[model samples]
Target: MSPLIALRAFDDSINSNSSVDGVSVVKIIEYVVIGIVVLSLLALGYMGWRHRYNLKLLGEAIAHRKEKHALAHGRRTKDVQ
Candidate 1:
């Protein structure tokens, strides 16, 4: 027999023996689990972005405060001399 005919026969044998109901249920559950994992990762990425932005804002505020303090201290010393 040809290769195509041999493959068709093998497929027919497999289909005849396998049950469809249990396989469909298992496939549905597997897809749901995969979707949950993908959604969890997306949530984690959003939280990380928010945390980084907050840290950047805090650092800028601290730097500005330090500069203002230094300028005021310098003027006080100049007046005394």
Candidate 2:
């Protein structure tokens, strides 16, 4: 659902007053499952982003090390004499 629709639904849920005040077992379980699913998705996304960043950093580090090693060995050019 779009953000607007979700926001409207949330607003409605919050504004409406139910006839019964007590919470149902089914509702509790549903809420728990929804929360868990949302959290799991968030965690998965974060991990994926972190992994990408780490890979990029590793690539950069490797490239830097290669450049430094080349300077140290005085073999910067790839062309053979």
Candidate 3:
């Protein structure tokens, strides 16, 4: 909403007898909080997925390096201890 509209709503709420605008304000805050929570959960899930993918790559790299080292030392691939 525009700043002018928001200011008008606030002004109307203050002048009104009932708590009608207050209910809208509370609903807006509730929606904002729910949105934040959902976004944070998605971000954390993505981070976790990335971390696992990186770990798998690191493991493969380490295995490749060890195999290369063993081959350089004249050891068979399966015989390397």
lDDT of 1 by residue, 5-51 (tens): 55556555665535366554334445676688899999999999999
Question: Comparing candidate 1 with candidate 3, which one achieves the higher lDDT?
Answer: 3
Q: Per-model C-alpha lDDT, please?
A: 0.67, 0.73, 0.75
Each candidate structure's count of clashing pairs: 0, 0, 0
Worst 10 residues of 3 by lDDT: 15-24
Worst 10 residues of 2 by lDDT: 17-26
lDDT (Cα, tens digit) per residue for candidate 2, span 1-81: 964456556655763443246654445555677799899999999999999999999999998899789989987735558
Q: Cα miss at 40, model 1 (Å)? A: 0.9
Per-residue lDDT over 1-81 for candidate 3, one digit per residue giving the tens place of the 0 to 100 score: 965466557756663543465555444555677799899999999999999999999999999998889889987577536
Which consecutive 10 residues in model 1 have the weakest lDDT in total?
Answer: 72-81
- The RMSD of every model to the true structure, in order and in angstroms, is 10.3, 8.1, 6.6
What is the number of residue pairs that collide in model 2?
0
The collision pairs in model 3 are none
Judging by TM-score, tell me the better candidate of 1 and 2: 2
Candidate 1 Cα misplacement greater than 4 A, ranges? 1-23, 75-81
Pairs that collide, model 2: none
